[model samples]
Target: MSRRQRAASLAQGLLVGMTLGYTAYRAVTLAVNARRFPRLDRPHAPLRQRPRVSLLTPARDEAHNVPKLLQGLLSQGADEVILLDDNSSDGTGDLARDLCRGVPGARVISGAPLPDGWSGKNWACQQLSQAASGEVLIFVDADVEWHAGALDAVLAELERSGADLLSCWPRQDVGSAGERLITPYIDLYLLTLLPYPAMRLPLVATATAVGQVMVFRRSSYDAVGGHQLVQGDVLEDVLFAKRLKARGYRVLGALGGERIGVRMYQDYASSVNGYAKSWLPVHGNSRLLLSVALAGQFCVYTLPWMLDFPGARLLRVTGLLERSAVAWTAGRRRPADLAEGLLGPIGPLLQLPVYHKAIRRKVKWKGRVYEQ
Candidate 1:
């Protein structure tokens, strides 16, 4: 065989071998590191002393979804449910107050004007935190819905783990074909790459938090400067987790599939824009890192399917299976999304333009322009 043919054969072998090795590693890590919330139906002895729990939500132009979240929080028996309408042109503040009228311990606070150095959500959450009168603070997004006993389950997990902060991954409620093609990757990356158990280890910087639903002990929140430390950060959840980890606090992340759900975006356009706002900051606002990361994602997820060299089919099948397995482990149950995981690279590929926009400080979210 010619030198070129021999080189091609070696590369094919390497691809197949690497795929198999990585798949096995993911499977093992998932089994050991992935933590799932207890089912609501499962019986557990109630805590003798229920701590005061506050439910905090920040909203901007989320008038349509805030009512649902309010209803869910009201049902959860929180001591206080505080909503911040973040300087929305839409009547979000009025709608929130109307929804909570006559509901004991529920209040809506109009967010102060955006301060010079703070992101909108961060400012909103800081206001909520200050107004909170509970020992345990739970932050839920307006788009998220909680099942019966969700709060109890989260508190139970937090107590059991002895974590200073606990974050839960909600089940993705996909609406559009675009959502199916894109959203599953969030879980796939976490399952495959993040060392979930190491989040609690001292001196280890590995940390991740889902902002959709996070429960924090008031003490821990205060210790980390609450959201104040990450005031300007677009990805506040991640930075908060890192801050907690850096302070030698225990941070635990669990699957909330049985307890909480979120419809992250309505359609293709929203998904592109919504993800870009958070994704850009997660890469440290570095265009070079974003490019390298996207290229790596394509190689690991898309190249196998696109290539026709010997053993390519084996590598492709392995890639698809690996993604599907990780997605399932992360609480994605939709058959369509599982199938779409085969085309996982599409999500990252579509975000290339968004990354460029983000680097240029041109990304708009909730009608607010954020400068990088």
Candidate 2:
């Protein structure tokens, strides 16, 4: 064969090897972990002595969402529910007070002014923490809705696992085509990349958390300095989990599945704007690492489909199957969502511009600039 033919053969062989290896690894690990990982979506026997549970939610212009959350919390059997109104231009505080009126153990607190060197969400959560009187503190976002018996299930799991901090991954409720196309990547990375079992090991610092729903023991939160330690971080959830693990506090993750759900963004524009704010921070704000990660995902998921080399079809099919399995396991696999996942690298490819925008500090969220 000519030198050109030899190079082509080498490249084809390498692609085939990578495709096969990744497919096998993904399929087996996902299958094994599916059974091993703890799920909070199921029912559990009631706790003998319910810990004094305090539910905290921070709202910023969440007038439309607060009512649903308040209604849900009323049924969760929490000892108290504290809502922090974070200087929303809209009448979120008034709406909350009106809805919570005459409701026992539920109150809305006006959030203090944002202090320098602190993110809005973090500062709000810290204020809520200070006023919380529960033994178990559950921090939830305004957009999250809890199913019946969700709080009991979480408390049961926390007791059984003996974890100081527990973060539950809510079932994502995607509305628009943009949401379906983009959001599965979050679960994809969590399921495939994170070594879930190793997170408990002191040697491995592979800490991660979903911010939508997190339960922390008040003692542990106080010991770890709570949100105050990560006050300036945009990705406070992940950083707080890491800090807890570093301090020898046991931290665990659970799949909320149907027990808890969140509508992350309404439409394409909102999705783009929301993700742009944290894409760079998620990758630790390192431009080099972001480039490598994006390039690597593109090569693995999209390059084979573009090539006309031998075994290209097999490579593409394997890639699609692996991604489909990931989506299915993550509870995000609908026909449309899976079809978008099959299109390969479109999601990560679309994120390139968002990453650049984030790097340039041009991303704004909730009327605030997150300039570095």
Candidate 3:
């Protein structure tokens, strides 16, 4: 090789070395702290009486998922359920009304029109809160199917922790490689950056949410001005969690593990489209920052595998050590290994196009299409 080529190779080797070292450090840190991740503590047999709990669901053209949700909430040990049908063209409104008709303390209301400066889900949630009378409000998405004791367990946690807000990151089910590669990235990002223990620290303010389920104290909800305070946010749940911390509230997040799980999208197209719908608004309209974020995700996730390729044999030695470290940090050997060594390379490739489309596409969200 020429002198310049030798120098370039050395530089690449050094880059790989630093990257692997950082990966190992993060992995070990994560594994050591893994025990701190939240778990659902089973309610004591003589269960502490929970406050009056309200199941607040915001639905829009969720007819397919609504039935399952209705069934799940009805079976939970809660005081009442309020389903806010957010102007569905499908039979969602009718289905909601019909399901609540004979069920005790169950009621459904058609949400008001979407006003200016308000994101759809937050607006719908505002309406749901207005109609709710329970002392504790549980925000559940229409897509989520809850188990019989889920609410009871969540309520128990809220009471025991004395937290103003409680949420859980449900286990995600992935059928296809697309789902596996893209879906878990969200979880990895969360666990890597917002480890449960760090979230309690005041300097920790990177907003994160398991929007599938969030339970809030009625007074705490009102104290932070509720959904109305966050109406303009596209990522309302994330914003709400941050706002709660900013306002001196104890915000607790649990690792759903297998307790709560949701199938977020049906297929690859749906998954891509779904993310595109909110990508730009969530990034504050800075495409440059968005590009940088995407690039960072790619490098961090894909670096290990690239090192293992035949042309990059030098990287395999470095990559394997780093992979071992990430595995340690995440608490599960297989997930961290696969995520860093295998999926890491492939995962970010899928995201680049999604970012491009998010910049160009006029997309539909919750039945309403918005032009970018």
**Between candidates 2 and 3, the TM-score winner:** 2
Give the Å error, residue 107, model 1: 1.0
Q: List the residue pairs that clash in candidate 3.
A: 27-326, 27-329, 30-329, 31-329, 301-344
Candidate numbers sorted by TM-score from highest down? 2, 1, 3
List the RMSD of every prediction in angstroms: 2.8, 2.4, 4.3
Clashing pairs in 1: none
lDDT of 2 at 40: 76
Q: lDDT by residue for model 1 over 238-352, one digit each (tens)?
A: 8888887877888778777667888888876777677788776778778788887777666666776677765557656666676666666656667875776566545457656
Which one wins on TM-score? 2
Which sections of candidate 2 miss by over 4 Å?
A: 1-24, 309-311, 337-340
lDDT of 3 by residue, 1-372 (tens): 999999998987776666556555566545644667665543324347758889999998999888888888888857889888888889998988888788898888888989998889989898888888899999998877777567666766677677788887665555565555455445555665555667667743644576778888999998777898788776677778887888788887775543465667777777887777767766776778788778755555566455452324544444344434434433334553355545444556877767978887466666676665
In candidate 3, which residue ranges exceed 4 Å CA deviation? 1-14, 41-47, 175-178, 204-207, 281-285, 303-342, 361-363, 369-372
TM-score of every model versus the real structure: 0.90, 0.91, 0.84
Candidate 2's residue-wise lDDT over 132-235, tens digit each?
Answer: 99999999999998888889889998998798989988877777876666665667767776656766677426778888888999999998778997988888
For candidate 1, the per-residue lDDT at 344 reads: 53
Which candidate, 1 or 3, has the higher TM-score? 1
